[model samples]
Target: MFWKTILIVFSIFLSILLYRAYVVFTPDKTIFESCLSSTANHSLKFDQNRLRTFQKLLQFQTISYEVNKQNFDEIKKCRNFIKEHYHDLVTNYSEFVDLYDIAEYSLLYSIQGKNLNLKPFLFSAHMDVVPARDLNRWKYPPFDAHTDKDFIYARGTLDDKGNLFAMMEALKEYLHAYGQPSRTFYVALTHNEEAGHSGAMGIAHHLSQQPFGHNGQFEFVLDEGTTILEEVFPTLNNPIAIIGVAEKGYMSIKYRIAMASGHSSMPSAPTAIGILARAVDKLESTLQPSQFGRGPELSLLHGVTPYLKFPLRLVMSNIWLFGPVIEWVLSRKPGTDALQRTSTAVTLISGGEKENILPTSASATVNLFNDFSNELEKSLSTAARKEPLDTTNYLACQCIVTEFIKIIRYTWLSKKDSSLEQSVFFSLNGYSTLNKMIELTVTRDKPVLASER
Candidate 1:
């Protein structure tokens, strides 16, 4: 009887494995099939003069070191360059475009479209870039704007300037090509986004006073995003661009403990440092609640499952059966882990000054990036449901939803271990590549992208 039971168990295990393998190897129609096909070739023209102008912008040292500490002259010069270059919108089209200066340096352009019925949207990018520490480590001067056969290397190339310049150029091209758009939109260029969002806050306040700025009036707000990554999936052979839909919330907490001070020779049972160390360790070991399936990541996984190769596709599609295994694998890496749960990192620790003395008090600073996407999603859904959408708005809404999922999907999948090649490529080539890509994508998918929904 025991031998017969063993044989039966082995047979069942083999059957299950075979079934899983079959499921993994087979292909089926996916909802994301439409997005996979290549669309019409729509390209943006970027002449050498445009590249030179971008290089000139990079030459400016608009660095933000701290609150009230910035290269004001450089900032002014950069703004002047923008105003001079975009004279068509700033001066010539004054009747249609309204430009406002917020927080002295920040810029806001409110463009009135022909259509008044459509909801408006906003696009934002910062003007200031963080100061380059350890300048000696740079291949070229931080503000030199060195260009080769394939790249333009500079300090603020990737941070904000690339996006900002690309956006401005795209807008200029659109206005010149097709005239005023049907939907209204706003462009906000914050002066101090790196040090803080003070400029952005001021702009927000100014907008809030306007009638259209009432809460939840704008259709969407597009801001800075992750890079277009190559070889995101081990099996998938394509590059992907990730848009940041929502920003991660964060907080830094200082953990402290007080105990009797003593000499090292006669230390107490539990020293303050020891206690603090254990607390820090416990915080790192005990992770926040997993929001894997409950968040947008699940939708992301579902969308990309069809594109994934072989066993990975099967495993992702059958998440119900392999959730714990997948979670365990993801939790092993810090980058991937952040997508599933809040991350805790003990950044700084303080204790004894002298080696021979036991510290009376010990403290550690823990920085945590909160994972509240599940709650945020629910709230957003509720808010969206409160206002009924017309067909145009609904399609627009669907496009936004599809794009959001694609963003998260690419971000999640690409959150793998970075290679030296990736680091070097991103350092030099990423910014310029991203600029052209965004210009092309925004122009190409202006309306057709809605159909992908």
Candidate 2:
């Protein structure tokens, strides 16, 4: 009877989750056809000339790694190509286009408008393309810009260069056809967007150097984003355009774990690598608090609600009543979970140098895209663990360390052998500098981000 009761409860729980998943979102009218009515409906004629320029742009090897500029010649070649192609733009419209080259790599084209009455807008595009690692893996050469009929295959084709050129192509045609725009515009084509945001920072500094309210505040800024997705919603046959309402907050945390080092041949049980593995595993397993229902997820669901069919429509329409249930369902998915919680990713790790030697120290980098549930400060504070939220996973790693440290004690010729004695060493090391930095940033800027519910 007890087993039967447990089984029934489990079955009920499973049913509830399914029910919530099905009743996920509220229906709203599709905004696709409706948006064409606005000024955004302006005709953009991207001819063969534009397309060829785009392909040529892709051929330039504008690559960077972690703030370090790489392939300077190729990058300069690409910039020169832009200058040559947009000669009319640079020469005739020189004063208007303010072709200021900041950082020698970034292009900050500030187009001063005729009407000072209107607030200016900014167009952000990155010139840098990521390196194509292992040339053999690619179908055609990554830089070749191979084309047939349907698509142009290249490295920066999808991510950024395509968007950047599209903006330029549109502007080139628009400026040529219809002189100066009523409202001012700033075109920021950053050279270091792929690695360092130095280019963007340079542009900001340039703007600050200008007179107060130089271009006034912006009307609205547009960036490369979700173009359209037909299959995004469960029952929607319609294409959905995702307008980013908000951006997620970003933070990187570095942690170091230390243990006794010795020869690998001697084979210490709780070696540096072994202890680190346990700790990293625990960090991965211990998840953050989820905010699915009361977050931006509801807004996303609402956008697609109108297209949902049958009982699915009924479920979504009534999300208000079953929000927690929906949250539970959404939390099951990694993509959806990211929308709801402060995400954790162990990006970097370094432990040992040689195969034969056991290292004394291990370090890891944890990058988090923090949600703006309360604000940046509170969200990060909540994520920081004073108490282990996942006691089981936390204790499991500690237990593994405790047990293995015994075997290591014999090999290392250590003073303390008992688990309690060695537990102090197994404990985490706090870096004061990093702590102060994070605290200062959070307090000053309150850099927070989250999906709106």
Query: Which model scores highest in TM-score?
Result: 2
Question: What TM-score number comes out for model 2?
Answer: 0.74
Output the lDDT of residue 420, model 2: 24
Kindly list the per-residue Cα lDDT of model 2 for residues 143-199, writing each as its tens digit. Answer: 889987788889999768888898887788678767788878877777766565456
lDDT of each prediction vs. the true structure? 0.64, 0.62
| Residue-level lDDT tens digits of model 1 in 145-185 | 99988889899898889989998887876776666778888
For all candidates, the clash counts are: 0, 11
Q: The CA-based lDDT of model 2 is what?
A: 0.62
Among residues 3 or more apart in sequence or in different chains, the pairs in candidate 1 whose N, CA or C atoms overlap within 3 Å are none
